[model samples]
Target: MTNIKSQSWCWIEKGEPEKLILKDQTVRQLEEQEVLIENSYIGLNPVDWKLISSGGANWKKNHIPGVDGAGIVIKTGNKMKHIQLGTRVCYHADLNKNGSFSTHTITNGKNIIYIPEKVSDSTAAAFPCPCLTAWQSFKKVPDVVNKKVLVSGAGGSVGYFLTQLLIDAGAQVYVTSSKKHHQKFLKMGVLNAVDYNLTDWKNVLLQSINHNSFDIIFDTVSGIHATGLMNMISYYGHMVAIQDRVKENTLPAFTTCISLHEIALGAFHTYASDAQIADLMIQGEKLLNDIGNSKFNLRDLNISDFEQLPRHLAELKNNNSEIKYVIKV
Candidate 1:
């Protein structure tokens, strides 16, 4: 209902976070189905930096670049009823649009969910990308109860959520991450935790599991690593890849019966039907509710002020640390 000026970090050119510049920009009138949010916190993900490096096809000079945020709905356009002014919410912005890195952002009402009362702004902001991707990836496998599952890169955000979801659903979970995370994973009920830093970690993993193949493999590390994990799948098992999937031609002939799934959560904004989009919000709300109800062991977020976003992003690009970064806007 009211136009506001937002202080935002804008993409000036492609390369790294350093290319972004801070500026005050005017938010225009919202479309009938859109809502205006005053962002309280912004969550960082690898995709943010990756898109910055590529200068996303839809990006222009001074385009705001972020996907995850939580805040209050300051204004709502005429057609919005479910989302009201002053409602606390969180969202994953459409990749092609101006995003959540600003003090304010505009998104369709359907693209966001109400934050549960018990969830903190940082947790809500951090949940959408990795948690939703994990939810979708977990759903790809039919039923996990009593099944043997492996989560590669289990120390990462998506891997962490996926691993917890699998364990909560009664799957016997195995993980491969840094040695520092081994004890944590074990304490969380992981049947085995292999330190991928070891030269023969994969062999160690196999030996620890008694050479038995997994019924499902959730791979957060792709490329040759994903391909290498193929032979470890049981007959008719499923493999969900969060990054690039193994090329079909390169798949071992004996592994032909296994199912391959690829998860690109951002693509949902561009390609999903109305029903699918609705389901996305529903699933997100479920995750939020779960978080509020103590069904998840939330990780402590590494907090930073808004101005430190670029520096944190640069560090994220170069490091594989498990710390989740949230920018207080």
Candidate 2:
């Protein structure tokens, strides 16, 4: 028989090198739309560390701090129509509740999806936060089919997926990554991959793409030459940023008339209406299904045992690792 009781890695105090302790936590009774899951894997993100250090608006005292996980659904709420009791699932937990650091966690049925048999639990766990964020960012852009697009940090998690999605959709996608990964990006079917590290990399991109400006600039590495990047966008083009908020200094000239979107997955979870949230959940599910069909790859994952979450997250804070880390629960 499986254990219903769960152990959670929790934050008891705030700061760098987070004061995390594993505690036996009670699994709450399920609401009509919730499901109880036996977690198998947990994927780490910058937000997990940020919640500990900065204690953002969603951070609660003595709370677990992970958003992405894959698990088996042990119990489904009375009103859940799409999930079954024995199904394997992957999900992004709600900001208002405790997260996926626990052995057992509860999430809304709508937010969870069945993991295909061919996909490993760790890979499934890796998809939720970053892939959903990428999908939302792309949704914000208009008419991407055959449009010229540039993904500034194409080597990162969200950028990796978004670049492929844009490529699959027939967009003329270009990318920027370290020189070492430029060849890999080329094999992924991008129009061109330029080494953003070179001092003259911006000019190199312009020279390679025939001096054509981009219709959309997806800025994943925020504050890295923000003004110069925006200047390369075609007039009336759009820019989507996951991190850096555009300040007056970073904003483009008035004549350029660029459209800017700052996309945050947390904002959608916290602020969207029920209908809108449902739409996002459906869109995310479709993307996951598409990935399961082998149309895209989930690359560069760093796996660790659950016990090493804190240490791994500390390493992630330094921003040196090239891969996203996943914890086996």
Candidate 3:
């Protein structure tokens, strides 16, 4: 008989990662079009902590502690292709379901993408969620030549890459993050950085020539407080959010015409064609290569805990400054 056993991490109902309701649990068998992957690294995302402290309670029961992981393909169903058995790969599993916080996980082969040899495990692991989100979000933006792009919350994983990509694309980049990150962000290529903690960030931004003057604003954290960037948007500007907040707490009144969007990118998994996905993968491959080459600020890093995933999640959720968190299986 098959052992039918593996270890994984899961979250509790609105609980902290340390309180970890479930730890080191056995995994189920792989279904068709599914593969059993031995996880090598873990990439932490905002949603992991977001759901824990705040959102997505509907799918709360199966809340595994992670979403991004890199691993070796151990078992593949007969129908799988391209991604061969025993291949080293990285993946962004669907967060709606359980995630990659375990020694082994059963996942659909479609969501899995092969990592380039040049990409380290930590870089590859980091690329899945934030990288993909940034790529998908940028592809949706309109003209890119000389347009002013304002990225609020541009310090986290997705925000970091989004800022880098926008700067690389020739868009004048304006950012909002902690003051301490201002110098680092400028070094990372942001044209300008605003301190969100400042009491008068608006007036501070208004003083700058590019302030209140953006064509596109990508704000990732908009759940609780007003980002104050709403005042900076030019008329007819587009505001895109990975976490658009709209619960009573609204932005200050501004007659400027604005369009808001809450971009999940998960729908891309279902709607994007093979060629489209291939294009995304191609983009992902190149960016990851650049990042791995020290073209940017990312470093080759790893932190491991297989059976102790719950504890790890707690630590990660505590202070998520970096992007990748690999679980040495």
lDDT of 2 by residue, 99-202 (tens): 89889888888777678777888988999888988888888887899889999978878888899889988899999888777787788888889888888888
Model 2 clash pairs are none
Candidates ranked by lDDT: 1, 2, 3
Error of 3 at 183 (Å): 1.8
* Candidate 1 residue lDDT tens string, 1-329: 45588999999888988778999888989889999999999999989999999988978898899999999999888889667689999999998999999999999898998898888898999889989999989999998999999999999888888889999999999999988878888988999999888899889988977988988998998756787888898888888888776666355576548988888899988899989999989889888999999888556689999999999988888886467899999
Model 3: residues with Cα > 4 Å off, grouped in runs: 1-4, 21-27, 53-63, 210-212, 223-228, 245-255, 269-279, 296-304, 320-324
**Compared with the true structure, what per-residue lDDT tens digits does model 3 show for residues 1-329?**
25656566666667676655545566666677888788887776666766666635356655665778888898876667556778987877765667777777777776677777777776687777887888767766776668888777777777887887788788888888877678877886777799877888757765765344778888877744334555566777767776664333244455666766566756555677877766766776677777767665453345665656556556666765543455666
Residue pairs in clash, model 3: 41-326, 42-325, 42-326, 212-232
Question: Each model's TM-score, in the order given?
Answer: 0.97, 0.91, 0.84
CA lDDT scores, all candidates in order:
0.89, 0.82, 0.70
lDDT of 2: 0.82
Worst 10 residues of 1 by lDDT: 247-256
Q: Whose lDDT is higher: candidate 2's or candidate 3's? A: 2
- Could you tell me the C-alpha RMSD of candidate 1 in Å? 1.3
